[model samples]
Target: MIGEARRALPLRTATSRLVVVVRAASAADYEPVLDVLVDAGIRSLELTLTTPGTIERLGSLIERYGADADVGVGTVVDREQLSRTIDAGAHYIVTPITSAELIEQSVTHGVPIIPGGLTPTELFASWSRGASAVKVFPASQVTPGYVKDLRGPFPGIQVVPSGGIDIDGAAEWLEAGAAAVSVGGPLLGDALRGGDLRALRARALRFVTACSQAPRAHRSAVPTRP
Candidate 1:
């Protein structure tokens, strides 16, 4: 699964260490927003289903940005969305909650799934069942220390912190052992609302620089015997 995951999304790369979550009011807003983001060196992009017409437009978006960045679907909560994402050739699928069936289906389809969970049990279950990595949602609730504590028990688990991750928080999570940091509002700001593209580019670049400069946590973990 890890090998498949690496092929699906290279998290260790400077370009993909920060996943830009593109959630807008409409699917039409994605291209311009993604253009600035990709131009600023973001290689992993997640387009959520929360946006209108996302499923219908996903294939074209993937075709357009496939070579430069990994285009994926997020906020997936059911089998239908999961199946559609796979059919559209999404590089990956990210769900807001842990679902054993979803994880299994993704594995069967050869797509890496990043299932979200806040508690240790939920995260562990996702990882143990063949998830590429577990997403720690509502990252604002717990500090980076929470990730470190999780490592004490699940040494081999890889976590990606999502929800409310700011520029500085991105680096902090990486340093705290997150496999990747997912950013939305902080990175997108009002860009999707007809805001300045130049400002968006500048902010995206700053995030890219921060992730690159942050000291990466050692990925290999050896479990300690109690």
Candidate 2:
């Protein structure tokens, strides 16, 4: 299945411009955390490996919601972690830093991988290594213009902003040429902290709406997952 992921990635990216970061506060928080978002029409989902049992939980998620969303693993930093994630049926892999070994592991498996990077050198290196995309970490510390500036030198690289992005900031990132915007904390807000699912649903819709209204040239905010 990993072998087919790369071929299908572009289609996946074109439609999924709003990737939600799912970090479980506890093992018990995992399922409900995903249920509300998936039910809210989130198509692109990233389950961070930083959470305990995430690698173990990835399989069940892929089994239960794989049909409704793209269940990928994030914060993956090494070949061992990458291997475990792939074996757990991850549809895509994400790393917090560029790792040739990790990228090679993913590419060897034919699985789509998004490696994180902040500098131009790191981002371009990932692209040259056949990364599915580059995740721009700590995006909240910078403005959307930073992404535009990055594009000036490396115009063809695909970047997805991850971290500190709120619903309103989603569109600005997209408008600035980010292939997609990965949101957590701000978007997840009180959900993981035991907030009402109804309120979470409402917030999810707002993020979705903000993403949907961005210029179509940025990327199609498809409501469905593969």
Candidate 3:
């Protein structure tokens, strides 16, 4: 199906209402960290392209953890990256900026794409253009109230607040009507640098719990997966 035939969906999973963004210096750092996060109850994983060799190791990562969690590729900026991500079997795609071409390609290939945007126009254009959801990036720059206010003009849009979101901020955003929160540093800590898997698991659980406890808004029904 194409853009006009598909519906925008949110990032949802049975394990948690949070998307754990893993951005390490090396792709080698992904497995152990992912193992800990998955063990700690996080099921939606966004492995960004910024990390070296992410695209190369993606297929293997999915083969290892696909059944346990939704393994997606983020930071997709162009058609080439999007194609490779799909070929690597990414469950979904997330871009740092809204691109009509990328969104169209994603929809054409049947991959859910969450395009990032900060303004109302950007978000709406993405949503109306077939983005699976709109990612409110640099969420640290704006409070949860920004998302709440977006709901006023765009009641049916599904927004996932990403970038600089902390454990508590995850809850706050969710309570403000965000479909889900995409978190990285605050949740990963130093695990990627070989800090401690046990500690990583603890942080993962904390984020999961915080999101679970937040109040959910009555959002337009959308599938959690592609």
Candidate 4:
């Protein structure tokens, strides 16, 4: 499955370092918002499917940024949306919830998929189906300690904490075992509404710096019997 997907969609460069999800009102907002993230050294970005002219904007980003940025579509729910995202040149596809058909489509196209899940069962289910990673949505509802616990059981699973994540919360999530963190409002904040590109850039930098400084906890070694 993975092999087939790669041939069709061609995975973007590793986004495991930093993934930024931006929800904008219009296509005009994408370039500036994306510039902020790219300036902050964030290579991965998700332009929500709900955004106006999503495919058009996706195509523009791919055409302009090329390999300099890893652009994808988020909030994708069905196979139709998935196909359009790929057609628009999205490097990956992200859905807030799992849809096997959508995942299969992404694989068929060769783009990576990140499906959202809140519980252990859901997380495992997504992972078992070949999700490149699982997004832990409404992450604020679950504390960092919860992430630590989940990691204990699924050590290799790539967990990305999504909603309610700020710079500080992003640091906490990474320390707790998140492979990466996605910041939306906190990073974009009023920038979109107010058109404050400077503030947006500053916020993105803060997030990047925080993630860089956050400590990764050492996994506890299992006891060896005598």
Index of the highest-TM-score prediction: 3
lDDT, candidate 4, 1-226, per-residue tens:
3322332122233333467787878878777777777877777788897888878767778887666767878999987788888888887788999667776677655567888889998887776666767788878788878777776777666677889887788888888877678778888887777667887788878877888788876644322111
lDDT of 1: 0.84
Give per-residue CA lDDT, model 3, range 1-226, as digits (tens): 3346443443444236789888889898788889888888888999999999999999999999988889988999988999999999998899999899999888887778889999999998888777777999888889989877887887767788988888778888888888788988998988899797888888888888898889987766543334
Comparing 3 and 4 by lDDT, which wins?
A: 3
List TM-scores for all candidates, in order.
0.92, 0.89, 0.93, 0.86
Worst 10 residues of 2 by lDDT: 217-226
Which candidate number has the best lDDT?
A: 1
Global lDDT of model 3? 0.83
Cα lDDT of all candidates, in order? 0.84, 0.78, 0.83, 0.73
lDDT of 2 by residue, 79-162 (tens): 788888889889888889988778778877878788888888888787667777788887877788877677667655677888
Q: Residue 58 deviation, candidate 4, in Å?
A: 1.2
* Candidate 1 backbone overlaps, count: 0
Q: Candidate 1: deviation at residue 166, Å? A: 0.6
lDDT of 4: 0.73
Worst 10 residues of 3 by lDDT: 6-15
